[model samples]
Target: MNRRERRATAARQSGRTSPAALCQAGFAHLRSGRIAEAELCCQRALTLDEQHSDALHLLGVLCFHAQQPDAAVEWIGRAVQQAPKAEYLLSLATVLERQDRLEDAWQHYSRALSLKPDDAGLWNHIGDLLWQLGRMDEAARHLQQALKLNPHYWEAAHNCGMLLLELGRHAEAVECFDIAERLNRASAALHQMRAVCLSALNRFDEAEADYERSIALDPSLAETHNNLGLLHWRFGRLEQAFACFDRALALRPDFHAVLNNKAVVLLHLQMLDEAFAALHRSLAAAPDDAQTLFYLATLQLLTGDFERGWAAREARWRLPSVGLVDRGFSQPLWRGDRPLEGKTILLHSDEGLGDAIQFARYVPMVAALGARVILEVEPPIQQLLGGIEGVEQYIGRSSTPAFDLHCPLGTLPLAFATRLDTIPLAQGYIPAPPATRVKTWQDRLGPRDRFRVGLVWAGNPDHKNDHNRSMPLRTLAPLLDCDVQFVSLQKGVRDQDRAFLADHHDIVDLTQHLTDFSETAALISCLDLVISVDTSVAHLAGALRAPIWTLVPFNPDWRWLLERDDSPWYRSMRLFRQTTRGDWASVVDEVRVALEGQLSARRSRLVEPSPTPSAAPVPAAATA
Candidate 1:
């Protein structure tokens, strides 16, 4: 037992029944975890002297520890009234705060602070309460005061760091974490929190070191493991990421976020069955989790399970990670819930250029339903896509046009109840480029003497999966070696590719003249074929019914289903998929062999001409 317990035992053995002695014995019993004995002692002391403030305070503490907040408040308030002591007031404030009587708690806390003006712990407590109330600025001030009063206050420093981290002030949070670490180097939680700040600042190596240190200090921190897994996931270390997630799940089986994260890595690894199982388990743990549901939708769509995919696709808007704004228009969103005989419906683009291009096919179908369709899409493709058959009006991103109902373009598939077989315009729907624009491209190119191909090797670098979907221009050297005219349809070529492009003069770089999708479309119309990676250009070529061979990654975006050479969404598109992840060489080889075969077939057809008259020579410009 503690020293107080020993003294209390000596007093009891000597038959000392004084009120002060009994109160002391009670506190000793309470400290030693003898709840029944402590309560009996407090009652006996109160019977001897009902106004004994120490006995009353001990009883209040007992009630608090027993989870009787109401009774604890009554006893503590009585003790405060009798003694008017700072410690008694502090106890009363803590109990009142636990009961969520914020005003009462503040009154008691203010009384205690007034009595003990320099109490650093009291300042920290108030700061913590303010943080919970979302009074961030006040919380920071109070926490700073606590630190100023006691520079070595680890708790206050840690609290300040957490607040800064919540505010997305990673650099400031790291400074606070540094202060905390100096005071307590053995704290695993401190290391973990600091690692999160480092990760946010993109100091990956430092973050990894801190994560390792935290795990070494305490292996049971499931949150630390989950965070480390996310870092690994960002770097594409799939196996390591899965291991960390598995460890986190083992520590906390009901960790729904970890389960969801694990499923995402599984999806990237093409372990569809495993990802499906993990997502279901996460839903079982937390059924209404939007992120998990969105991932499940993505997995389903990737595997061509369109029925369930479209059903859950609406969850994307609810996810902060997707960053899709709800637009919150006054008009209700139409999801085929009501007939639209004469109503005007706004169909706006919700995602990237390729997605807008792919889903714009739904405009005609919506118009056929007797609704006036006003299409709002990104400005870059607005001119080209404005000509979609059913679009009565085409506007740029910021328009607030009059419409009876609205829907994001991504949600159109669900509104149409689209399935694998029900995807609209598989034979292509986008109208041909305007004649004048096509003529502009024709004038730019004099003649086509060889097979003409447009090449797009990369897409937007900021895309999340750009590393997987896009390749260096050098990777296409084999394909470019073919005896054919090549024109770069790629915009925004990276600095790494600029030197190669300068050396390879055979490959025409005409992108400087192509300002928007309209210009690109007109140029695409003149080319015999388009060879592109998964990008907006590929989608454009497909929608225009132009011949397109799209190179796909091993684990492609949801649109390109597994192991298929053809796309259900685009009939004119042919897929060339990588057999392994990051193996662009193999894909390039396959495309090169296909190109050579097509050339050989053309030569044979030309020599075997018999009944049909030889056609007029195809202009060499056609090759571009």
Candidate 2:
């Protein structure tokens, strides 16, 4: 017989004449994927009793499954009004939430909770609603309540983990994920989330193993591959990262995040052309993606395409990476849009200390426009920048100085439409430290028979590329073998470098007394030259017009463009680059040779007559 006749026969055989019995049969049919039969049964029940809440609720569920949320809401509302049951309230709340009526949904959920105070599933649903509304802390509390109500609630545990992950409590999130995995080992998504937490905690090996496990569980999931690719990228495993990204793309061709990640890996591999192509595809997929746009700007700037780079780099302010420091200023950003003449402009440094030093050259240019300039920068560099010539006021960052306009220090290049060669004050705009601080450093040195050189072999450990840019004190052994007396310019030394520093008593370790950038600047002025990795001290040295040799990585930051020894930003600075990625040994070897050359040049100058009197030395940031 046909399906309808069979259902009728079954109904007759079961003697299901009452509305409740028919509604029960309707739910059974719905669970079995017999949508038409389910609807028929529910309609028959509704015909028998027009106010049957169960039948109405069943029909609402069917409508919700059919993507008719509006009709589902109508049916469920009637059912809840007639029955006032907890289940009916839950159904109505879920439908209202689907319709984006969050407040109405919340009220209904509260009513359901009031009726059934210990329903773990209902508590989980409430937590989900709060999460959607961006009430993360409340959502976490509700999810925790759900877990407390039922320890075996896998969904609640997973939700709690995800919420904690969003809150950046990776350790707590990992604990929740661990509980969830114990409950549901076959969940690929659970393993992937655990891997993300591990990765955030810098547990690379554990993170990679979990990612592999997740991929093994569900090979079809594109996001797992994408996330695995990011993990590989973090450790400089370029080939593996590229492979994961390729696999993700193969699984889902339009995955924009994977595309951007692939582009990043390509950039690291020095495949600039391919990287650009990937970024363009990503931008096409998500036109206004800030991270993608920022990478594009980075590529342009790295390749000396300043025309587009300066303008595109403006996307940094809108990026999530910059969100914490974005000053949401009341005054409009002055990008040379209006005349600066007679207007008070607040120039703020919202980036690294090196960036503040490098971009401080613009303060004089801005003041020359007849506008009063207020320089707002980090406290360390405030005294060092007292001699920028045109700064009307040097205010602490906490001060809310009244101004007609404001601009990020980094955006000054774009303000003037800076080109390849038009960088102002290439010969150095920042002045030397006061003679008093210089004398303090000189007295600390006692005797000056040996050539004085400042050394900074490491950058900030917390920096994303610190592994690539920084080296241990032991790495500078080749340089220390020279006749010149080396002074430590590093502010914070890693635990691994402490032993080596202690053993090498010949190398000055007066960093304990160097309280701020002003002290560091004064010490740098006493030295003949400053040699550092890509860090703030390198920039400080260059800005002071002191001789500086910066050791650059293979894929250096955008500001240090490719294949050049000299910097346009700082005329007093020279760059020493690694021919291969992470090959610091080669860079050190080059620096050693250059040091020998500089010593020879110094001896030749001493022997030969000089036209000018002998003079001194210099300092690099992120986010430089």
Candidate 3:
């Protein structure tokens, strides 16, 4: 008989007509993908005969497919209890596995295996459960058993490849993926897994190809897009990276990693508002993501939201990898109102040389509270920082000075209640050494007819945003052709760019003869004006009270504050900001205008000096 007629005949012989008919009807509905009708039929069968294992198992599988794992577990468990057969036990194990109860699932799987000892599918299920429970050795054993039972078990081979990749056995993982792919060439998941293994091995080209193939096969896979985005981001392809992240978000709108990556790229682009929006969206999806929180805090600080920034910055200590500083210093930190009498305070460098230079202005403020301050500085700035008032001792890397209390240099801003207006812009804070260096610089320059301008076009190359902030010598061609006598105050002369300056007699390259910061200070003291990009020389000129016009990038460093023409920290400095992101032409043009004005004023001053006393001529006659 045909299958339908055979089922009908069986139902008639069973004598429980309604239950048998409903079971047969349920199987037909399930085969046609009419899940709701199938579930209704199964429920009717179970109502007629509560211990009907086939109806119970069908209902459980239906619920599992519908993502109702709790209901699935209940029905499937009942089916297993009523009939301890291979199919019923497998159904129960599937439900248990879905609910992440691997141990319970393993027990049910073993029972199923006992009923069909050589079933490759059952062995594969057991292997997957074992792997989920972190029993890698047992998982491998079971997977091997599955393969032996049926040598063409592609699903088992694919899973083994994934586990091998997890265990860092890349070569073995690759082999498994290869075999699985040969067995089932249409499996997108297998291709994706192989791509991940290749990526871990740093075979990016092959990994990228596999990832593309996986995407072509399964266009809705968000994870494939995210992995591709990460690959592009690592290679510095910012635009391509953002595009991949955008595609991933389109598929999975609430994906946290994709949102975070979008925020990161926006931050790189200096689109702060857009970046913050992306971060907020990410937080909405995962409110307690620590890395996202940390990044938001950094953005806050970088943008000058100090109060909120500090609150978020404090959260770093609570993260897993952050180490907390012990309060073991000799002197107590003075939080504004505290009297520092009899306290031996240590002011240590926290971040970079530029940071120390900028914040070292606070040391005197600390000392004003009657503490004997010991300034711990990096070697390069030890001499320059030593001359500032209130520092009783200069502690370099070689020094081991005793201190009662210490604080990070950056933290001094909060301690002192430093508002923008109250910043100590006292010029000549760092003193130039006595006439010796002054005379030497004056002799080197000799007699210049034009206004002498000192220039520094680049800063530390290691700075993350150096490419955007520092200008090349070629970009400085406009300024170089100007009439003023230009002197190079650049510290390190890159060899390739040196030849460009050779033919330019108007540009005086004093970089080689410069000895130290002290000598630079003296030379800057003699210049009519210092024109520079953001660098240490800019800070030096500002501190020495030299009139300086600083070229600022579009998204200037945090110290410059936002939308300001002048720095509160340097009264002698004028800022020239880029009109657009990374567009230096406008900034240079503004500098040109300011330079011409200065030169004009200098000429006017030289030609229009105060009239000398006519009576001084009589003293020359008496001497003759």
Candidate 4:
């Protein structure tokens, strides 16, 4: 009999066409893209023999092609109930994945992998799904397996390269992108990702070119402009970075990351109000963004808004950028609300030595709260800090101490709810090294009347803001014009600086003999005045209540606050700020003019003159 006659005879004899014939008809209709006919045929077969897997599978796939993933998943799920074939499972997974049921799709994909171990497309699909799930290393490995199965798999290469870029394996990402570029030369995504990797490696010129190329290929690309803005920001091109961020914002107005970046550039340009507005926009979009919170906190602190600033500043402990000083302590943090009465509190140093010195003023206040304070400090300043009134004992980092609660020294102000007006003060808080330690220096010069000034033009080399804050020693030569003896108090001198020191006349090299900060403090004790850039030495001098002039950058640290000639933290400190960033000469001119005035007055004294406030040091802010 002909196939149609046989089907009709079977249908008449058994009350319907056989499931196999119905499935055959369904597939035949499906092959010709007759979706309606295929679906009806599959439904009839399922009604006759509900467990017919192939007919159900065909209908599920047909529904998927017909843009009905919900129906496809339901039909495929029914097919899976009857013994599942590998192909059927894959179709189910695809429909599930389209419905955003990633875990269910992953399980089916895994099952299919077990059935067809050598399928490259299966591996690639699973890899892409894993990438979506953020299993970066696993995704890359599976992608690599797909590429091994088929060497010309450009999609796999690109995917693996993108995961590698996310993982910060820049060189490996570059290698993968090169292979993908050969296969898909016109892809803007490929170029943009390659530029991202290059920028991370600080290959700025090449990265810039690639960013431009990506934008040229796809004018609608958003990330390329954002990344180019970041590259410009890295090299201090503030205006260009701002422009790029503006372009990115035009495309994606609610882009919080771009907004935060634009805020940072605005901050660099000293556009405080604009930066604040940008930060607020970012915070409104992503309130939990730790980096943005900390940035905003710094702005608040800079503007002397301590109440909200300190609360927001606590976000640093949770942020990756700050690395959240994870001491692994079981004790909870003591925010100001807690009563510390009879509690043993471990107050530990967190940041640099200078920070420890600056905030050490709060230690006594903590002790006054009836809390027994155990102070832990950096080794250099351990001895110096031991003299503070509140410490029960000074401990090194290696010591393990049992305490009821603990706080970083930086957190003390926050714990006390300290305001700008309420900052505790104790001049000569840090004592000079013992008389025995300083006797040699005391005996070397028999109290000469020549005006002596201790000088430090540079700070630690590794400080993040050192490039902007520190000046070359040669720039301080203008201070030599005044009739004052310049004494070099700079320790940890670079080899380059040593040559400059040797070339310069009349700078007593005390750095060689200075053993510690105690010795540095003793040397400052002998000087008429101390002049230094923002460094540990400056902090030491300020804490000791020495007549010290702090040479600060235009955008000084938040602790220095904004637009002030005096430090609230140190009563003895007189600030010489750079009106223009990197303009050390103008700062020196003010110092020189002040010194000339002081000496001109000193020379007029009939008898041996004592250094007084008749012609006291001039702050750079005063000069302006």
For lDDT, the strongest prediction is 1
lDDT of 1 by residue, 170-250 (tens): 998898899999999999998999999999899999999999999999999999999999999898787889899989999
Cα displacement (angstroms), candidate 1, residue 410, comes to 1.0
Top candidate by TM-score: 2
Relative to the unseen true structure, what is the C-alpha lDDT of residue 109 in candidate 1, on a scale of 0 to 100?
87
> How far is 334's C-alpha from truth in model 2 (Å)?
0.9
Models ranked on TM-score = 2, 1, 4, 3
Residue 562's lDDT within candidate 2 is 91
Per-residue lDDT value at 600 in model 1: 90
Question: Model-by-model lDDT, in order?
Answer: 0.90, 0.89, 0.80, 0.84
How much is 214 displaced in model 4, in angstroms? 2.3
Better of 2 and 3 by lDDT: 2
Error of 3 at 428 (Å): 5.9
Clashing residue pairs in all predictions, respectively, total 8, 13, 5, 0
Per residue, candidate 3 scores C-alpha lDDT tens digits across 374-493 of 998887788888888898998885677877777777678777765544677446477666688888888899886778899888888877667767887667778776678898898876
> How far is each candidate from the true structure, as Cα RMSD in Å?
8.9, 9.8, 12.2, 9.6
Q: Which stretches of candidate 4 lie over 4 Å from their true place?
A: 1-175, 233-238, 426-428, 440-449, 494-498, 510-515, 601-624
Off by over 4 Å in 2: 1-117, 605-624
